[model samples]
Target chain A: MEFSLFNILDLLGTMAFAISGALAAMSRKLDLFGIFIIAFVTSIGGGTLRDVLIGNTPVNWMENTNYVYLIGVVTILTIIFRNKINYLKTSLFLFDTIGLGIFTITGVETGIQNDLDPIISIALGAMTGTFGGVIRDILCNEIPVLFRKEIYATASLTGALIFVLLDELQVNTDITYLVTALTVISIRLLVVKYKISLPFFTLDQKKSPN
Target chain B: MEFSLFNILDLLGTMAFAISGALAAMSRKLDLFGIFIIAFVTSIGGGTLRDVLIGNTPVNWMENTNYVYLIGVVTILTIIFRNKINYLKTSLFLFDTIGLGIFTITGVETGIQNDLDPIISIALGAMTGTFGGVIRDILCNEIPVLFRKEIYATASLTGALIFVLLDELQVNTDITYLVTALTVISIRLLVVKYKISLPFFTLDQKKSPN
Candidate 1:
């Protein structure tokens, strides 16, 4: 059933996101409580926002307490392997990208089920894929990388568009999901590998008046 | 009906929050687009989050576009009277506090209507009262004031608690709303007047091992 598939993917994404958040918190030298909070929000923030916006109350994680236990386990592991995890940046990146792919698909599909406009659906998908990290960076006292012309949101947006288009073309659901996720993961990897970015705007550099 | 009161308060709060957001953006020297975007988010971020969690979709601002116009107008006014407005800091603070009061009441009432737990309702109220500024601060690349042991969220929480308690005691709705809003506003003003702040902890100050 779709629920089982979503459950698996959601758990995987939560673990990956939790690890990323814990690392971020460690880097910032946050307290134990801060680390836990950051990890929880980073893992669930995007989906929480998406669910709220789509009128799904008591959100997914609120209904399923297991996600909390999973995040706790991930955070503890992250703390224990702090130094080792830092050295495994590439692995972390891959894990995070995988999460992004799965979350984007779920977000887009949820939007579709809610009968949202296609553009809004794609936006929801991109938001679900990226806003967790955005919240994470913000809590760490940094401008979100998403707003800094990073190729992050772009990758998710592209995947969401592809998924919508493929569905319109009568593609198989499984194949559509697979292709969309893979496309996002590939784009993310390529962007990072090539140092590719969107146009960078530094507003402070200009002296233009409003 | 409470609906009319909420509608008017909501509009006023939107304007105040929008102006505060515009001022923050201006202080950061963001471009016009950045100013507008920050203004929009700060005006609606908290309410949007609350509505989403309460299963309200398309969000209130999206459903009622007047909030957009109000923000746009507020942004333009802030830009045009930048220097003059900067000198009116006290007035701005009062306006922001008023918004916080009304938004808190609305948030708590919505939670009550949705049958959320009393504690959760209070939390939602505090979130509604403070999160617009939190999001604004984050977008401005600063640690949110809400997390910094300010007397901010505390004021909202106290008001929310009082509102819930009074409602449970079979208090008149009008008196409950007035008392709650006034309490929040009074606490905020007193806190500022007395330079009161909760104990602040900076994690980086510690050299504790993970």
Candidate 2:
């Protein structure tokens, strides 16, 4: 199938999410099926939630089984390199950050097609990028990185708003998409690089170490 | 709040699910927060998925914070009794069975209210009873019991179909609810009691003995 740049990005985003999930499974020392489950949920859980919210019948994964195959390969790769790739943590982080940015844009695009307002689109975009990881963490019985890690939904929110704002200013959709994706990835990567975090409600660091 | 018999049953059902989730967490040796997450999802995850499917906004648990506190208490109780309650496994199974049954009926009822066909209601009911565990298992990085344990959902499907059949025969709604709940609970308990399992698609266990 001839995929547009956006479609290609969507696949990349999915691959990234799946890899992150597989990495998490490796960390848990889970079995093969366990690795696949985490990868599948991490890659698709957010999009599935969004589809349900938008009343998309059959869901995207059910619509296209290719997604299933993609995640399958993702699990195999992570399993094969489980120990060797631990040192490539920086590269994995980059993949995850880039994937988050691309996925956020894809989510906003989905929301717009359904006629949601910009504010809602921004929120949906962030949800699309983040909730899968939250679900993954919850399954792994850990506090969600999105809930406690640095500048997560905030970065997606800003990028989504940027896309919406640029569109309102009559920018071409393709350019808007590219700009938003770059903006999101940059902000996320820079935050991680600099140990920057958004201000959030916290009782005390002693209370929650995660 | 005004409560009907079924409503009371619903509360118990929620408590049962919460307790099951808490116990699962306890078995895994999780901390207080992990137990809380398990209890919360086990209690509310199934219905939340159903509601989202039917386009109900804000979700059920989001509207009722009381249930959150209820799950909180249930989790604490599980934590406290973790060592002592291994002997009470049968009672716990009974509670889980009853909870699954009532939950099935409740989900089907909502689907019927939305004017979905009875077949869809049957599906909704099964989804309601099964999805929380699916979500729970997925988060815990395991293949959902649904994929491997056929009888787990078969009990729900049978009970849901029976509920529909009783309604078709103009059975009183109250009696119908009672019979359906009992039927599901009975089937589940009996299955577990007898070590009954569904034959695999190949009539051979697909899993490695390892």
Candidate 3:
């Protein structure tokens, strides 16, 4: 609740995710209520999951009305600016990337605060960074891009690992956060730009027929 | 944790849910690992969400290895008896209904134990009973049946509401649970038997185009 650089980035991340959720819902042609629900989940679903896993009671949004108000505002704005926002795809993408970076760090730090294992912390970070979109895609009745084509979770994982390593080495907190967030943002941008993706496995045609 | 009738019913519910999940995954033609993951989530997803929302840390499955083992065994059994299981559609439906009933009670009790309002407890109960399948359907890239059709969530909600009403009157605990579970099971069975479903809503063509 204190105003800080981290808090500011968190708000930005929430706003970005909310807009993306609204856009996705609009594409699905959901009613206003459905769009609101999807946007709400897409913005906070990951953090809510993380907090739940860590046993953080009442979760974050329940404690702070600001997040709820923020998402509501963002959803309304996204709806109003739908066509104009389509022209700003690059800007939206950048915001989403930034959100991914910030959220991953937030998850990792939360895990550390809870004294979880580094491996689990990294998993939490990637999940926190990516699961909102996963939830969004699921509600829209599509395979999550995370499990299919993107290096999204991998990027979050990489940043989380780096953050943990730097933290373990007792690096300056501010520098560690900056480096980790930048690393995630850069990896996502580069991989997406290059269309890089992990190889997908397919069942043998003779063994399994669909 | 106590070796009570409730505990027995809980385990049975877990097993039934796991089998249903494995069956669903198999039908999807997912590989063995995918099937296992699906089964695991399907059995525990709702409860995990419930526990997390209420700030119960480490979640239920983490605190108890029995659920993990039960799901694993159930998944293996389901795979081995997949064809035979298909012949037992009636039995499977019965088990699923039983699971819905028991899990609803468990969720409502947990919420009440945490001193939540009756309305919130009822919501938790319904969510606990139904969200596992919601997650399963989402993972399978389909619209959740809960939203589209079926009296599934409705049955759970009805049972939850009845349970809350009964509890408010300080009814006998054993009788309360039994009545609640039976109410849920009977409602689901009747609904399905008669092909009853909630009416669907569609946006007007003039208002929205796809």
Candidate 4:
């Protein structure tokens, strides 16, 4: 009952993830089945891992099989509309950012509900936020975006930590979620736009030079 | 202590599955990462799914850490040895067959140990036995090989039934396992050699004949 808003965020997260997945597959010139597989993994992969880690029984997909059917529907439509698709890169990044934000919030909420410590919750949130894309990239045979991109997972971790901090301050749940989502989205969007990546040896170099 | 043999079988299973996955990825003309992805899934996918379904915590690969490392090692070696891999198809098939037999037996045994009924055990066994290749094919963007060729899942089911029946007769566990594995391998290998596949259904054909 406390997680009444979960259903909405869950569906939102899944839909956004699916769109991003399909776009990524398209960029790779994958066929219908390949596109579908990527879409399925991207949409559910992080949450699935999170759920298993948390010992959630029956899994999220089995409890509500409609997610499965929804993915199927989206995949079919993507294939049918393949030739009509344009703006390959930007739209995908946008969808991916949205998914990352939504899933981060939910994952943090779940860990909090489980009464995990603040640090563990933050880790869970980040895992929930980024693992799907990691899995998708790994399956597609690419180094995870986490490893290659600057501030990808780091952005998620930052947002999750902020959320935990705000919750400790007794902030309202809705506001915490909104602010956290914005935090994740803004950080990721900025990183993409400015090509701001994690400092490679920057931290170490500063310390050494000083 | 008695499970020492089970550990050995699992190691063999991993090797077998990895080999099959590598070959399949090569056939699909995947890049190195793609080959590794295929190999990883082929080696661990079914067990992961089963663990998830059965609420096995941490999942095996995530827990062991070694399993993931092993897959990576195999993938790298497979790539470097690609020139020598041409002669490996026969060995790959043999290893795959052995893995299938061992996996089917282990899966059914796990189900039984968990006190699941015969039907659920059969389902789990089949799922555990065949889901790896199914996931592999899907990742490669193909309809699963098992669906089209050699009565693959059917063979797993056949072994599961034999295990249940023999256990009911108070058969020794080792003998039962050996018998079931041999039965499955025989059926699968024979079918492969003979090019035996399930009959195709045509929409124009009448099921009324059944």
Model 2's CAPRI class is incorrect
Can you give the lDDT of residue B20 in candidate 1? 83
TM-score of chain B of 2: 0.87
What's the TM-score of chain A alone for every prediction?
A: 0.88, 0.88, 0.89, 0.88
lDDT of 2 by residue, B1-210 (tens): 357775666677788888878776766777778989988888898878777777776777787776788888877887787777765546456556777888998877776777766766776788788777776667666655554432567778788899889888989999988888888888877877687765321111123221
| TM-score list, all predictions | 0.58, 0.58, 0.59, 0.60
> Which pairs clash in the backbone of model 3?
none
For model 1, the stretches where C-alpha displacement exceeds 4 angstroms are A1-5, A11-19, A22-41, A48-98, A108-127, A138-143, A146-210, B1-45, B52-91, B117-123, B134-210
Among residues 3 or more apart in sequence or in different chains, the pairs in candidate 4 whose N, CA or C atoms overlap within 3 Å are: A150-A197, A150-A198
What lDDT tens digits, residue by residue, belong to model 1 across residues A36-150?
Answer: 6678778988888788777688677755657778898998877776655434445446666887888898889889889999899999999998888888887787667676544
Local lDDT at B74 for model 1: 85
| Better-scoring candidate (DockQ), 1 or 2 | 1
lDDT of 4 at A134: 86
Cα error of candidate 1 at position B81, Å = 12
Each model's lDDT = 0.80, 0.75, 0.79, 0.77
Clashing pairs in 2: A139-B139, A139-B140
Error in Å for residue A109 of model 3:
0.9
Q: Which stretches in model 4 have alpha-carbon errors above 4 Å?
A: A1-3, A202-210, B1-45, B57-87, B93-210
> What's candidate 3's i-RMS value?
7.8
Residues A67-106, candidate 3: write the lDDT tens digits: 8789989988887767665334354456567778888988
Q: For residue B110, what is the lDDT in candidate 3?
A: 79
